[model samples]
Target chain A: MNPLKLVVVTAGLTQPSSTRLLSDRLGEAVTRQLADEGRGVDVHVIELRELAVDIANNFVTGFPSPALNAELEAVTAADALIAVTPIFTASYSGLFKSFFDVVDNTALTGKPVLIAATGGTPRHSLALEHALRPMFAYLRAVVVPTAVYAAAEDWGAADAEGLSGRIARAAGELAELMAGRPATSHATDEVIPFEQQLAALRAQQ
Target chain B: MQFGIFTVGDVTTDPTNGTTPTEYERIKAMVRIALKAEEVGLDVFATGEHHNPPFVPSSPTTMLGYIAARTERLILSTSTTLITTNDPVKIAEDFAMLQHLADGRVDVMMGRGNTGPVYPWFGQDIRQGIPLAIENYALLHELWRKDVVDWKGRFRTPLQGFTSTPRPLDGVPPFVWHGSIRSPEIAEQAAYYGDGFFANNIFWPKEHYMRLIGLYRERYAHYGHGTPEQAIVGLGGQVFMRKNSQDAVREFRPYFDNAPVYGHGPSLEDFTEQTPLTVGSPQQVIDKTLTFREYFGDYQRQLFLMDHAGLPLKTVLEQLDILGEEVVPVLRKEFAKNRPAEVPDAPTHESLLANKPDEVPVEAR
Candidate 1:
């Protein structure tokens, strides 16, 4: 059986960012959960800070650079996504939203996404619902029900209410969602046949 | 293979100095550019149509008609005529008249104009752009082929027993090439009619165009036009060349750094590597252009964008001289070297008329 492909997008600005730490923990937990279900997984991590200029350039040029293109293909080809971003101004970081903005809107249709965020305080937790979730909803991605948010203090706690518990719950849900799906091929790159496009246009009219 | 130049007719301030040409000088310069294209041995010159400011070629046929009277052997064509907004009836009449004036040296590429407001300015809704293109071109196709037509569609009023005047020269409709940057439906439309499919290959990456052109080819074969290799394909390229490669880059950098439409986006070096814009010596331009045939198969026409981004008129004319004298002659021979015999040459009025001998008018036949 082929391995399920997972893409983890981290929008933490710093090198040793807690947001990426949360992303890595969630990714490892998801991998373990999927493995326990006898499903193998291939994980690809995208560090958005490194691609900041590329994303801005893509906005202006209407096309991605080659490196950005490969990253976009990875996100589209994944059976599931674990998106982690540092919360800023009660929302996902601007870098996080901008990266996804460059992604083709239709690329994420029906994709299973696990939403997570890291912030200085718990007040920003609802941002996962108000901001990121709605954005994914607009893209038609099937977001996992459990969203994990880690405040600065949650990283040090050791109880059920801590970041680890939420990470485990979200990872388990994402793994459950991914385990039932087949490995996705990059078939979205294929152009629809002209007859089909014409039929679609005719049907719309 | 046919080699030519196409212009968007932008009225930009020359980047070196802050001086902008008056609209009159700009229009005259466009005419001078077309005449120079013929004098330098280029095969064709195509002008873009725009209804808004900063663009001057709103009436392509009028300008082409004027060029038709001045130039002798140059094929006058449009980079694209808006099929989504303008009445197809007008398109049929204008190009047919231009064909007569140019003595069968006219063709038009159909496109959904890029500007959104132009749709409403022309009494069209921007939301119906594709439908308008599909329906309008369908009527335009009929208007040229059938002298008297009865047609009804959603976008336009029904036409009954209407004759488009000045029927195509010698009873042959000017060849059509559907220019699309990304839309596969447009490619299919071109294939459906066995017309040419042209990729606006300048602004975007070649891979994007490769898929569109590849699909056009496969469907062109599916429609039984010919083998996929035999499909008529045209590609747009842009180049700035000098005798010295570094000098080429240095000379074009100011214009490239601030020109409209992708200027200030990517560095010239990066843009050159990513897109088809070549800033190098004439040999470099030839080498980069020859790779296009490899990417899109053997194409029919190659049109370079030589005159945008506020390059001075003198510089544009000089570039044309190098293109006609240095780059194209080599490209022409190289492109022809191992081209498959089955691939048809770019269709002209004469070639189209020759293929339809039975349809010729009574006297012409």
Candidate 2:
């Protein structure tokens, strides 16, 4: 059996960022769950901060640099995606949204995703549902019911256990979905046959 | 085995001298470039189509027709004729007239124009670009081969018993080449019709176009047009040449730095490294161009973009002189070596006419 490929994307600007810490926890929980189920897992982490200029240049030139191309290929071909970003101005950071904007709109269709975010306060935590989850839904990804958001206060000793429990629940839900679906390798050569395309257009006419 | 120049017809300010050409000067410059292409030993001269400010070639047929009246052997063509927005009826009539005027030395590249706002200005939605390309080209295809056209499609007004005047020269419509930078659907369209596919190879890495060209080749064979190697392919190259590589780089760095498409984004060095843009000695340009045969198998046409990015008319002419003199001769000789016997040359009016089967007109049908 082919091993499952999981790509974790995090938009953490600084080293030792709590957003990255949240991503690590989520990734570990998913790996642990899948390993316990006797499945091999391949996890690749994408740090969006490193690709800030490439992302911006892609916007300018209408094409991605080779470095950004690799990241795009990895995300599109993975069996599942773990996307985490820090909330900025009541939504995902500009860098995070720009990355997805450059991705083919149909690439994420029917994909399995677990959405997560980190914010300075719990009041801003709902940005995960109102912002990130909806964006994934627009891409037609099958997002899990449990979205894990970690506020800065939630990283304190008082809420550490709470965060971990939420991470475990979301990870378990994601793993269940990944294990159910066969490992995916999106075929780059797949194309709609010209006859079918013409027939469809004729029907519309 | 055709080498030529394609200009975007932009009126940009020269970065080094801070001088901009008037629209009239730029229009005349494009014509001069076309004439120069023939004077120097080149095959084709293709002009772009643009309707917005900063771009002057909104009327390609008029310019090409004028160039036809001047030149003797050069092929007059469009870098791309818009398939999405322009009425295909107009395209059929215009190019057929150009074919007669140019004595069958005409070909066209069909593309869905990329500017989003230009779509709405022409009463089209950019969102429906692919479908519009499909339906309109289908109509254009039938109008040329058949004497009468009865057409109804989503994007245009219905036509009944329309006869586009001036039937194609010798009843062979101009050869069509589908040009695309990224879309795979365009590749499929080209393959389905057994038309040539032109990859804008200057913009992105090779892998992106590799997959697209591979798919086009596969489907070209699947549709029974020919083997993968026999499918016609064309590529776009951007080069600036001098006797010394350092001087070439020094002269072009400012223009490359401020180019409207990719300037101010990446350094000139990185852009050249990642994409097909080459600013170097004649030998460097020749060596890099030969690698294209390795990448895309055996292509038929190679058109370099040497006139854009605000390079002056004098510099562009000098660059073309070096290219036609030093670079292309070696590329032609080297690319011909070890090449398979099965690959076809770029399609010309005479070849297409010879290959066309005997058929009677409306009286017999």
Candidate 3:
């Protein structure tokens, strides 16, 4: 069996960013969870910090740079996604939203996404439910129920559903969602035979 | 392969001088450019059609009609005639009329026009763009072929036993090419009819066009339109040349920085590297252009966007002279060398008329 391809999208602005740390943790946890069930995995991490200029340029130019396009291609074709972002004010960082904005919204439909965030305070933890979950829902991605939030203190603290525990739980849910599905092959230019397109139009009218 | 220039007919201000040509001057300039195209030994001269401001060519056939009278050798065509907004019957009538006047020196490319308001202004919903293109072009295709036609579609009033007059010169309709920036359905539509598929290779990455052209070729063969290599293809390019490569870049940078549609987005150097836009000496332009056939597999037409971005008429004329004398002669020779005979040249009135089957007119039937 081919290894399940997992893509980790981290919108970490700094080199020592906890957002990326959370993303790596989530990626590792999911691989372990899937491994326990004898499933092999191939993990690919995409750091959005390097893509900031490309993302902005894509908005202005209405086309991705070749480098950005390659990363987008990977994200769209992966079997599962682990998206981690640092919280800014009341929502995910603008860079995080911008990265997903460039992705074709429908490309994530039925994709298994494990949404996680890191911020200075645990007060913003519910942001996962309000912001990330709803956004993925709108994109039609099947976001896992156990969204992990690793606030500044939670990283060093041990509470119920601690950072590590939440990561494992979220990873487990993502693994289950991914385990039931095959590796996705998002053929970019999937041609609908002209006849069928005409037929579909005829049906519409 | 046919080589020519395609212009959006944009009335833009020169970024360096902040001077915009009046609409009158722009229109005359297009005619001058067409005549220069003929003098320079270019094979085709295509113009874009846009109804909105800053774009002058609203009625393509009107301009092509005038150009046909002035030029002898140029194959007058359109970057795209709006297939969605314009009535297909009118398109059929107009181009056929132009065909007669031009003595068959005409072909047309079909495109769904840009901008949302152009749709409502023409009584169309932007959401139905694909269907409108399909239905309208289907009618235009039928009108040019059959003497009379009965047609019913969702968008327009049905026609019964109606004839589009001045029937395609010598019983062969103008060859149609579907131009698309990013639509697979358009590519498939072109392949289904064995019509030409033109990729607007100027604004986007080459990879995008490679995929599009690849799909078009695969589907062209699938639809029994000969082998993929035999499917007719056209590509768009943008080039600015000077004696010195640095001079070309330096002179074109202001226009590149502020040009409409894609200006101020990517740097000139990045745009030149990523897309087909080349700003350099004649040799650099030729070297970059020769790689296009390598990427697209010996296409039938290569049209450059040369006259836009407020390029002064004199400068544009000079660029044409360089193209005709220095660049294109070399390109023509290089493109023709080791070229497969199966790959057709850009279809023209004569080739199409000659290839027309011997058949009785529908009126006689």
Per-model TM-score (chain A alone): 0.92, 0.92, 0.92
Q: Is the docking of candidate 3 incorrect, acceptable, medium or high quality?
A: medium
The numbered model that scores best in DockQ is 2
Candidate 2 residue lDDT tens string, A70-171: 999898898999999999999999999999999889889888999999988889888999999999999999999999999887877455458888999999
Spell out the clash pairs found in candidate 2.
none
After superposing candidate 3, which stretches have Cα over 4 Å from the reference? A196-205, B361-365
**Any runs in candidate 1 off by more than 4 Å, and if so which?**
A186-205, B359-365
What are the per-model DockQ values? Answer: 0.47, 0.57, 0.53
* Whole-structure CA lDDT of model 1: 0.91
TM-score of each: 0.96, 0.93, 0.95
Rank candidates by lDDT, best first: 2, 1, 3
Residue runs of model 2 more than 4 Å from their true location after superposition: A158-161, A201-205, B150-161, B356-365
lDDT of 1 at B148: 96
Query: Candidate 1 — which pairs collide?
Result: none
C-alpha RMSD over true interface residues, each candidate: 3.2, 1.6, 2.0
Q: Roughly what TM-score does model 1 have, to 2 decimal places?
A: 0.96
Docking class of 1: acceptable
Best by lDDT: 2
Best by TM-score: 1
lDDT (10s digit) by residue, model 1, range A45-132: 9999999988888888889999999999999889999999999988888989999999998899899999999999998899999999
Tens-place lDDT digits, model 2, residues B225-294? 9999999999999998889899999999999889998898987888888888888999989988999888
